[model samples]
Target: MRLVVAITGASGAIYGVRILQMLSALGVESHLVTSRHAMLTLTTETDWTPEGLRSLATHVHPVGDVGSVIASGSFQHDGMIIAPCSVKTLSGVANCYADNLVTRAADVTLKEGRRLVLVFRETPLHLGHLRLLTQAAEMGATVFPPVPAFYHEPKVIDDLVDQTAGRVLDQFGLDAAVARWEGMRPLRERQDQQPDHQAALGEPVNG
Candidate 1:
């Protein structure tokens, strides 16, 4: 499956990186595009240089190069994911403003009735942010936020990122083994393995 992955200027650059890593491991063809501001985030948030990030994908498209293959609807792909999608990029997609390759590809994805998942990374949203998100959802885009799942009992930050990435991939029907939530346990089952169960499930055992 070919997947277009876009990393915007969001706070959590790791989401995009983890998505690329999982895609590569799953043998999926990843076409990556990083915004100019995304590059800045990479330097500030991660050790990855632009080239290092590019190396993770099967194809890398420049943000300004709107003539790229993914920019057109004819370019067949399974889906597109804008990991760590910034509010600016989210607005562009919400409004169908294809001023750059990222938004153009996203617009094409929506027009073609393909899955377009936007993993928006923002906090303390105002009314404008909520409206834009609703607009994007109304246009058949999945507005996914990279919220951490505490139920997964993550031991490290990578675990949280992986769980979020895995869940996001679930929207595309791709299983990355990142779902950390186990089902609710029966009374006997819970009591039989209370300590181990709590540790494994990231839940607190009461008495």
Candidate 2:
């Protein structure tokens, strides 16, 4: 499978790294791009060197390359992901602002009726943010906020990261990580186990 992965100037650059690792593991080829701000964020938030980013994708295009193949709807890809997608990139995609290849790729993904998953990372959204997200949703872009799941009983940061990446991959019909959403014992098992778990945290267990 082929996918386009864009990293923007969001706080969590680690998600981008993890997504690349997961995609590589699944043998999915990635066309990767990162904004100037995203590159800067990597320096500040991660130890990702230039070589590390290059190693993640089959082809790495500059963010300014609007004429790149992935930017056109004619280029067929299984899906696209903007891991740790910033609000700026989200707004650019939502408003049809295809000034750069990343946004253009996003626009193309929506127009082509392919999966476009945006891992929007901004928090405490105002109406403007909500509006842009709604617009993107209306255009068939999947607006996935990077929220953790308690149901998974996550014990580490990697667990949460993998679960979210797995969900994103599922949008493309690709299983990149553990199937966190399937193969449950039953709803009764969850309900039966929740009381003890919640009680340990001194919280009310509502089944």
The candidate that achieves the highest TM-score relative to the unseen native structure: 1
Residue pairs with backbone overlap in model 2: none
The candidate scoring highest on lDDT is 1
Q: Put down candidate 1 lDDT per residue, 1-207, tens digits, no spaces.
A: 999999999999989999999999889999999998998998899899888999999999999999999999999999999999999999999999999999999999999999999999999999999999999999999989987888655789888989999898898788897756678768896567545866678776664
Task: Give stretches of model 1 more than 4 Å off.
Answer: 186-207
Off by over 4 Å in 2: 179-207
User: TM-scores across all candidates?
Assistant: 0.89, 0.86
Model 2 residue 195 distance off true place after TM-score fit, in angstroms: 14
Error of 2 at 118 (Å): 0.7
